[model samples]
Target: MQYLESFYNYLQYERRNSSHTIVAYKNDLRQFCEFLEQENIELWVNVTSKVIRSWMVQLVNEGVSPRTVTRKISTLKVLFKFLMLEDVVDSNVAKHVITPKIPKKLPAFVKETEMDFLLDSIEFGQDFTGLRDKLIIEIFYHTGMRLSELVGLMDCQIDAGNDVFKIYGKRSKERIVPIIKELKVSLVRYLNERDKLFPEKRNPYLLITEKGLPVYHKLVYRVVNSYLGQVSTVVKKSPHVIRHTFATALLNRGADLNAIKELLGHSNLAATEIYTHNTFEKLNSIYKQAHPRAEKMEDYI
Candidate 1:
């Protein structure tokens, strides 16, 4: 517990980790420390790979999912590496601990038709709340920004003259995402309504509540959920699914993978590569529909 605070400070001040990520890392490390306390281990220097394995085994036995266990292992690896760098430990004991293999699950996305219906068919009124709600959905589908980044959007971050959003992504890394003409028009309408209704500066956030306060995560989630529920039957109608929709749409239309990586503000191409699977599925469907030999393969045989 002594070095835990310092480790957290390093993650915050030095690593610039988001608060949500820091809290998750904190919880994971606290659980690991509790495991150590149960085993009568007191010092980080005294910990061993074998002990870490035992902890992992205990987690599996307790019915933790493989993906969750893998994340916990990652947390331990980071913590031990940090400890080694700070000279709190001689070497990284968690380095040799093998993580459980996690199954790759494809990200969920709304269909293009479903998105079309939601954006075009749904009648969001000309009122301020209606304009704000419509703009919220449009921003997610157009920008592919994370929920946190969208919620924390400031008024000045929208570079209208440049036709791009200055998005600050994970770890405070900034990336500029260009906006389409349609999205830009929607954004202009929303800002005008927002300013007209409020008429007083309460917060710098671009999106705000009906009360003119900055929008919170739950509010944004509800807005996306409500609008998406009208058109999409996907189990998750949250902002993230819309983000997936954005990336998948671009990929299906032959946009460069590297271009999508930049637009989504992903730190690595691997993160953006997942959407290719979705695109492949779409292509496979098209192939089946168009190919002459696809329907009756027995003829070829």
Candidate 2:
């Protein structure tokens, strides 16, 4: 547990990881610690391959997704590796523990036509809240910002003249995403309304509620969900889905994967590669439709 505390401190201060990522790692480690405690195991040296595998099986039995179990295994492996580096443990039992294979899932996205209708129908003049929500949706779709990065946005981070906004991503890393021309126009319109709502305050957030308070995560989620529900019948209509829509749309239009990775603030290409599957599906459909020999000849026979 003491080592966990140290790891938390390392993540917060030294690694400068985002609070969300730190929380996830902390939770994963906590679950592992609780499992060990229940079995009367203490100290990193007491961890064994069999105990690790059993914990994984228990998680699966409790209906945890294979992806989640894999992540937990990764968390433990990293923790023990750190301990081994510090000579806190005699061996890395977690090293020999294998992660369960997870099936690749396609990223969900709204159709471009549907997204256009949703954005166009938003009545920005209805109220300050309406204006704010409109801009929020536009930014999410245009910029592909993670929810945390979008919520963490400050007013000073935007360089409107350059059409770019700075974001603080995971690990407190900084990246600049360019604003599309349409988004810039929409943002300027929102700013006009925002100024009327908060005439005197100097808060740095671009989006705020009617009370001039910076937007919170749940509020953003609700706004995204409500608007997406109007345009989509899909069960999972959230901000991340909008972000996915943005990525897939770009990839479909021939944007470079590496460029998209940077824009989306992905730490690795693997994280960004999911969109390729969507692109591949699109290509396959086109091939089936346009290729003369693509159709089966058995129907004619």
Candidate 3:
């Protein structure tokens, strides 16, 4: 509680973390602080490794997922590290705490054929809303950008001459994502239609509502979910699904992991490596179908 505000300011201004991240950190710290209060602890220095582990055990007993528990532990590490830098604590108590191991869940992606059907067979109509919706979906799958990046995309950020998008990803990190010719064509058409539909609107964002205001997160989510549901039975049909589809599609086509990491604006290659699991599944399926000995071996097993 003492240096919490200072830590938040450090995350916001010094680390340049997104507001979403800041809020998550805040919530995690609040929950930890509440746990401390229950233990009758009043100061940062009073927190111990044992108490932190006990709080973690309580969270698990309360049915929190291991993945979420890991994130909360990460929040504690950052908090105590900040506390040490500010001389609030002599040593970091959370540094040695063992966190729950998260299960490796493969990222879900839309099948290439299903994506093809949605774009090629689906008739989104010629109205402003329909055009906007189609373009939104195209951008998501083409760019592999996160929802916030797409929502905050500015017209000036699109480099038509270079056939690339200047995307501001998590923590305001910038990356250039190149576009294919087909996507370039779709983008040009959408920009023209957007201008014609809202001629006088001065919004700088690339995507906007029929009311000429910048499009919000829910609007984008609905557009992706509605279209993806028709083609993909994937339980989660959000914008991030399309982002997954984009990454998997690239990996399937032999795109380099490092290249994909750059395009997706991931800070490290480990985040991009998850797509390889999906690619491996695809190859395994193809092997089962194409290799004569594969099916025979499977039957023997």
Candidate 4:
């Protein structure tokens, strides 16, 4: 527990990690420590491969997903390695712990036709809120930016002349994502209404509520869920699904994986590769439909 307190301080000051990431790390480490306590284990140096394996088995028996168990194992590995470097542990006991192989599940994405219908259902009336929501959906689908990145955007981040917006992504890394021409037009229309709503107050954020305050995650989720419900019957309708929709659309249209990686602000190629499954599914469907031999013909004899 003392080590955890030190590690948290290290994360906050030394590593400069984000609050969300630090909180996840804290939770992971806390759970591991709790497991150790439950097993009557003490002293970091006494941690062994056997103990870690037992903990993993216990997690599995408790109905935790393989992916989650793997992540927790990864967190322990990092902590043990850190302890080893600090001389608090004799060695990294977690080194020999094999992580569970989680099955890759591609995120569900909305089809292009469904996306079109969703956008069309926005009903671009004279109402400022409707126009604003439409622009919000368009920007999200077109850019594939994380919800935080969109909400944290400032007026200075937009390059109106070039039609590109700079976003600070995970780890405070900045990337420029281009706005499509149509999205730009919609943004301009929304801004016009926005000015009418808050003519006296000037805020840098692109999207705001009727109260002229910055939009929050819940508001964004509601906006996305409401529109997606009208267009698709998918059970989960959130901003993340819109992000999946954007990634799949790009992959289906033959966009480069590396390009998408940069656009989506993925630090690793593996994170971006999930969209390939969607692409493969599309190709497989086409192959089955168009190829004469894809479906075996009954024996002529």
Q: Superposing all C-alpha atoms, what RMSD in Å does each candidate have to the true structure?
A: 7.3, 7.5, 6.8, 6.4
From the highest lDDT down, the ranking of the candidates is 3, 1, 2, 4
Residues 88-174 of candidate 4: C-alpha lDDT, one tens digit per residue: 988888888998888877798888999897776547566888898888788889999888887887778889989999999999999
Model 4: residues with Cα > 4 Å off, grouped in runs = 1-100, 122-124, 297-301
Question: How high a TM-score does candidate 2 get?
Answer: 0.68
Question: Which runs of model 1 end up more than 4 angstroms from their true locations?
Answer: 1-102, 296-301
In terms of lDDT, model 2 sits at: 0.88
User: Which of the two candidates, 2 or 3, achieves a greater lDDT against the reference?
Assistant: 3
TM-score of 3: 0.69
Candidate 2, 20: how far from true, in Å? 20
lDDT of 3 by residue, 244-285 (tens): 999999999999999999999999999999999999998999
* Candidate achieving higher TM-score, 1 or 3: 3
Candidate 4, residue 260: Cα displacement in angstroms equals 1.0
For each candidate, the alpha-carbon lDDT, in order, equals 0.91, 0.88, 0.91, 0.86
lDDT of 1 by residue, 112-200 (tens): 99999888989999998888899999999999989999999998998878899999999999999988999998998988888888888
Over 1-301, each residue of candidate 2 has an lDDT whose tens digit, in order, gives 6688888777789878899988999899889889989999987788889999999999999999999998888888778877887889877788888877898879899999899998886455656677778888999999999898888898899997888999889999888999888889888878887787678967777777778888899999999999999889877989999999999999999999999999999999999999999999999899988888778753675
* Displacement of the residue 7 alpha carbon in candidate 4, Å: 20
**Global lDDT of model 4:** 0.86
